[model samples]
Target: MKKTIALLIITLMVSPVYALEALSDDALQNVEGQAGADLSLKLSINHKLENDKYVFDNGTGAVCADVQFCRLAVSVNNRFIDNNGQASSGDGYKLWLVFKGIQGTINIQKLGLDGMDLSYKDDGGADKIKAAMQLSFDATKPIEIRNFGFNALAFGQDKFLTTAGVEAGSTNASDYGYLQVTRYDTSNAPGSVYDHGRETGFMGVQMNGNLALQGKVMMFGCDASHPRC
Candidate 1:
């Protein structure tokens, strides 16, 4: 009985060792991933990010423009993760869009901007980025862009240079029509003012062609009277 017991124990340990080897030698798997869709974000650039607080609606006491300043800064913050486990971790995705005031005005019937599609999988630890149609911009690095431009048509033949533009007054904050322009005043304030000079009008962006993105943004308030929006 003792010898039988001893032989059984040996077999149990040795057999597991072989099983471990088999698991290690197992074939590699073809991990298939799901494709991504075209995602969009439409930002309603409303208020001025001031040093004191956000100023909106025909700004006064400092930052003010045609009714108030119309230019602003927008961005997308994200991170991209690569596959390979502990060996290689991941990467980061960040981008910024700065708007400069406009000069001459011109209406665009349609403007098609290109974008990147990201494919990924939940690889247990973190989301792995299988592939990306276009690469993401690195937030940490400073990428210089030249001849970056945008413009709009205000009345008829009047032209305006700008970083970005939108129609005024949409309950949601962004409109798809109407064009804006530029002119900087020395009068200084901490940030961009909204609805200062005049009440905000609908930014009729769709007729010209949807900036291709639309959604309501939750700011403390808006480029209007209410700040807690």
Candidate 2:
């Protein structure tokens, strides 16, 4: 038994050697050339701004009614796909939403996963979604979020995270504070809003209405606590 175990160990150690399939001279040269080929990409999003139709609060995150649905689109390599997998070259992706202002936490009642459509210059590599995910959030005031629920890696490809980040910010009283997640749901949404407790730092993304907490309000420093505020 001891001799058999020793042989098995040796065999396992040498297995990769046989699995290495060697290529021919021309194949090897072509493979080497392809390795140095230039592969670049860019991602852009198009969205139409709308009135504050989504319900937001310092207590309950965000809630959207069916009557008010905004649109979000993503454009990459001159092509786009909707959340339902329809492809278009002129317009990329279009996601429905309800906008709000005034900072708070977010929790989706039923978050769904939408796959991605990618276009590459060279088609030598595998054709599959490299990553996919869903995200959730918690609410706070004086505006803070610290918890996240994530669902990721749907297919048998690479491990992914569903939740991305929790973001909050505000400007005027009409559009001053809001919270949001990275996924959409038509039913049974699951998420939460964090007011205060031990679960504060669990959120990866946070925006503060005040600047003393090291958080940014508007992308351009609109909610300044300094003399400019």
Candidate 3:
């Protein structure tokens, strides 16, 4: 028995082992494969009214006291150049596009990444792979947006700036600013004074539905080869 165990140990110690190495370009071209991936996502941005104020749940069993609702704000800077090829003083201004009170649940059952393909193009007498990623999405599951809404759309200059410099662009009376469209009291006669003392906002929208989409989106790099790149 001892001799048998010793023989087995010697065989294992002398056995040859192979290490993995990267495949060459020629070898990689010969390899053919196909695969897909599935994704499930659920997003929610909601708020509740309490004590005449709006509050949001922070997902940790506590209310977010600092701000209300899920907000997205984008600011664009416009600069004007003078005849001397320099930026003119006080000629530059900023425009704000704010979407407030975003409340919705975006549920995607199965977002599929079907496959990827490589496209080749001729460039300067040589064949080269295009600098792009071509992907396809399967339409097996439809995307759902439930109770999606926003309280206001603020688009204008910096009139929404508060005393503390924080942006106040919501429909609230205290934070109301320029270029806001609100609901007016049209219940009275048309000739009577239209009461514009309701809410303040540029626009508001609420929608609920399932969107069916299935297609391929190609993301590519910008270069001189393509005129519209």
Candidate 4:
């Protein structure tokens, strides 16, 4: 009995399953965002990113998506504001879009505007990139982007991903959205200020303003290239 008990203990100690179970609680906690600011996160499950049909709306105001995937669009506007209710105009703000829960492999064919142009030719199966709010997983952090846009983000599964958009409201608060925002104030930093989201598999951040953003805590997993999804 003593020998059998020792053998069982040794077997459990060397198991990969045991190693996964040994992950620290803090490791899990690392995925959750801080408690101070309100964070809006959306993650889709089983969806693939497409580059040809996705579009940026530019806030031109014309029921923009008058068409379907052939002309689907999302309007984005940005500007700066100070602590004392002042709006800083002139190509004012930066916009970022977040993608979470991308399993398998993600190939970003286009990175929409604000300083980073999406191009599959450039990334070529690169695991991760952080150009704007789009967390391609490169650089491990989001880069502040200005003057770039995208047509669409293509993925394999449509139902597996969630998207979260954050409009930092005045006073350091934030607003969350899934599909779109009807009307938001772009005046004197007194409106929805910051915007961003998270993907379960990864998260990205881009600082267009000097708002001092922080790291995002996330919960995500991935399936390696294999026969069984």
**lDDT per residue as tens, model 1, 1-229:** 9999999999888884433433111121233345433333322233343584433333455333452144443533231222321221123221224343321222222222323323333334444322223322223232322112322212211121111232122343222112233333434463734433322333312112112222222212122222222
Off by over 4 Å in 1: 1-29, 46-208, 211-229
What C-alpha lDDT do the candidate models reach, one value each?
Answer: 0.30, 0.27, 0.55, 0.30
Q: TM-score for candidate 3, please give it.
A: 0.45
lDDT, residue 81, candidate 1: 20
> Candidate 2 at residue 43, lDDT?
19
Flag the better candidate by TM-score, 2 or 3: 3
**Global lDDT of model 3:** 0.55
Worst 10 residues of 3 by lDDT: 158-167
Give stretches of model 3 more than 4 Å off: 1-27, 30-34, 47-69, 74-97, 114-134, 155-199, 218-229
Those runs of model 4 whose alpha carbons end farther than 4 Å from true positions after fitting are 1-4, 10-52, 57-229
Model 3, backbone clash pairs (residues 3+ apart or across chains), number: 1
Global lDDT of model 1: 0.30
Clashes of 4: 63
- lDDT per residue for candidate 4 within 176-225, as digits (tens), equals 22222222234425343532221121223221211123333222332332
Candidate 4 local Cα displacement, residue 58, angstroms: 9.5
Across residues 1-229, which tens digit of lDDT does each residue of candidate 3 receive? 9999999999999999989998653455566667656778888667544584434443565432222335556754443333444553334223547675566667787765643434555445454444334555556677877667775676534323332223334566334323333445667565745434433356878777778778777765556554444
